[model samples]
Target chain A: MSTAHTPDRPEDGRDDDPQDRAPEHGHAPGHDQDDRAGYKTDADAGSVDERDEADAPAVDPAAENAEGGEPAARVELPEEQQGEQEIPTFDLTLQIRRYNPEVSDEVHWDEFKLTMYGTDRVLDALHKVKWEIDGSLSFRRSCAHGVCGSDAMRINGQNRLACKVLLKDLDLSKPVTVEPIKGLPCEKDLIVDMEPFFQSYREIMPFLVAGGNEPTMERYQSQEDRARFDDTTKCILCAACTSSCPVFWTDGQYFGPAAIVNAHRFIFDSRDDAGDLRLEILNDKEGVWRCRTTFNCTEACPRGIQVTKAIAEVKNAILSRSM
Target chain B: MSTPLKASISVPRSKDLEVNGVKYNRSSSRRNNFEMYAWLFMRLSGVVLLVLVFVHLWVNLVSPEGGVEAVDFAFVAGKWASPFWQVFDMLLLWLAMLHGTNGLRVIIDDYAERDRTRFWLKVFLFTTSAFVILLGTLVIFTFEPCPAGADPALLASFCAAG
Candidate 1:
């Protein structure tokens, strides 16, 4: 569970402001600035200046030579290019499902219309509603770009990370509907009680279980052996795939696709010793056989993990009685 | 004036039912991958079934014998007289029965939510399938076009003449 940490220092080219924390997971650098500038400028004159500054040369030797080599790059360009570089914005109506268990017994839809650019995500729309229009809007989100696995809600009746789904991908002709994921109990607006989801995940030991004498050096595993279970490693435990399952909805006790996916991660690992034990656990009546292969889990995975195929391989492993 | 409630995630539940902790009894049959093999068999047999079915259709319905009208008892008798045709038909009968049965099993598993319902449905399916396959195989191999019994009037006109 120990992650490799790179200590923060002033010389590391990272900003000191906590608000400007570096993008650690999936988002490219400078995306936060683009989104912020998009919101602030509303595609106005301010955006044009920013674009012009971005495109202008950083080290212009000819201009510097002309000004006695005294840093001509510091001089601002003429305002003509600034006029052409405009950020486009359009109005989008987000129909969000609102629920507060203490306040109400039923879920309700609240619509918020906001101006956003093409590059903005569904998470941005939720933020605009929470920060500007209604302070009472409640939801869970961290690492706003797709990594934290939080903010997995139903967007247009499909499970997706609010941060991962681009506004452009949705049909703007209709108001986009957002709700809590199906099959899990909704505790509040867009947030389900994740205890049951995590409970199933806990049943399958997600970590490596190695036995025998501790190796003096690192345990050697071939590239081909590592490649066997490579696809299952990308799981962020978002529960998007699991929640979308028809089997999980039908039988709550059934270990859903996510748990099987995690089991596949270690069950096929060449270095692990508990593969047989794990296989035996999955061999239960409610195990791999319960997967009817309707392919809802595969389609719902945001990480693009081949969930159904992994389950099939696990089924094969159980059959062959091999790891 | 009110103090802010601490924002903390809920503690995870203990794994009381993990492998070693609980007596994990399997409710379903212990046999593994009968379904797995069944799934794979469907695909592999489907390829074979495609070939066998097309050839059988061409010989009986389309080729020489023009259509459904040509497929009388005499035509069936002529085909079954040859060992090659009898064996061809036996293979076809077994493959088609097994393939169709596996497909129905998949459907039952998907649509039938109740275990007892699925079990009974599959029981009916397997029984009927076994009956058909056995009966078809028996008739294909042991069919006597002209039986020794004295029932010439009840037999096909060609069989009675022969």
Candidate 2:
């Protein structure tokens, strides 16, 4: 539950005002020209930030106090790239999490100033960073069209596939911060370890079980039957839905949304008579019961898969005691 | 200091279900295997669903015969008359329901954070899905397509053949 405090102050390296009392949580040094601290209560942000917004960074003072005592320490802290550097020429700025396990001592964010079309995607920015700025920056990518579902990452506190998110759709005034997915261990940069994710995935017996002898020839099925599970069939195994889940961050064992989306693909097959066995498997404590339905998966899904709908279908199957 | 017991128990089944050639162990989390397999089921079923779904779409809406209007009670009876359609429909029913329910399971876990709330919500979800799946399966396999001494219009084309 405890997070390591990240020492990497904001790009605008300004320290605490030193005038107002520093609360329990360390005030994050952000870009601002004021002497006031952003350490007020969450409720005070409206009143306090109202006067400080133009001159200071966009932050709620009281919001920081609630988390209490400094940023959670990440294995890699934000670097103290302090003091004013020459702001680069660009129509926009990109603050991306940079890591090269082979070279760098630790992962850190690197800001880039670029002149890009409004419709460019995070993937485009990353491509620019890798090719023009730093080839050492690593991330997974395939089927640049987004169908491969490989480029999923946390964008501005939300998990999304990089190829699918258009940069222009984001708030431009602030630096577009990006990081690897939360919960799983970081592999290189922007890629989390997926072993545990797959462990939960492969556990559900992803196969067709008719409960009878396996059919040598094609198994029989009707048209009406196929139409029912049509929607769940679109999942592309991308971890976007899974990483979007908050519970997944705390408990690595909790089966996440993408894994369940995969299971849903099979559980609905009529030719597979393994309902009893499948139900028994899914009935576990961390099974279908862990989803809190924040709609994050649905929002983050790159395939436009009706993730919530599929989850509903699975819930219906689990709640039915016949299993 | 009291350390929690790390003991585990498992049920031995005839054929172990595995995904991606990996065996599913229910012991690690000390949690039930319910959600684990539900996640797996989505992937597995999603695969088979690709085939079952395509053929189904091809037969129902894309065939040379008239579409949409050709479906009705009598149409259902006609299709059920063939064991192929019966088995196919049954598979679709089971997979879709299970897939759908597993998806809902994730929703429950994500949204229903409280213990009591999760428990009751799952109770309700399991009960309803079980009831529907049971009734549906029973109707599929044991469906009677004919009635004796009934209105000629209501009977199947071959109902009076007996």
Point to the candidate with the largest lDDT.
Answer: 1
- All DockQ scores: 0.11, 0.07
In order, the Cα lDDT scores of the candidates are: 0.69, 0.63
RMSD of each: 13.0, 22.2
Give every prediction's interface RMSD: 14.4, 14.0
Grade the docking of candidate 1.
incorrect
Error of 2 at A142 (Å): 1.2
| Cα lDDT tens digits for candidate 1, B1-162 | 222222222223343332322212223334364545665687799999999999998898888646867776667777888899999999999999999988898677666766789999999999999999999988887898777775665455677555
Best-performing candidate as measured by TM-score: 1
Alpha-carbon runs more than 4 Å astray in model 1: A1-26, A29-87, A98-108, A117-119, A132-138, A216-224, A252-254, A283-285, A289-296, A315-323, B1-33, B127-131, B134-144, B147-162
TM-score for the first chain of model 2?
Answer: 0.67
The digit string of per-residue lDDT tens for model 2 on B1-162 reads 222121222333234334443333333344464455565578799998889888888777677267866666666788899999999988988898888887786677566645478779889998999999999999998888875566767666887676
Query: Candidate 2 - CAPRI tier?
Result: incorrect
In the range A224-297, model 2's lDDT, one tens digit per residue, is 78766766666667787887778776445467787678778777877665555555666667666666667888
Against the true structure, candidate 1 reaches a TM-score of: 0.69
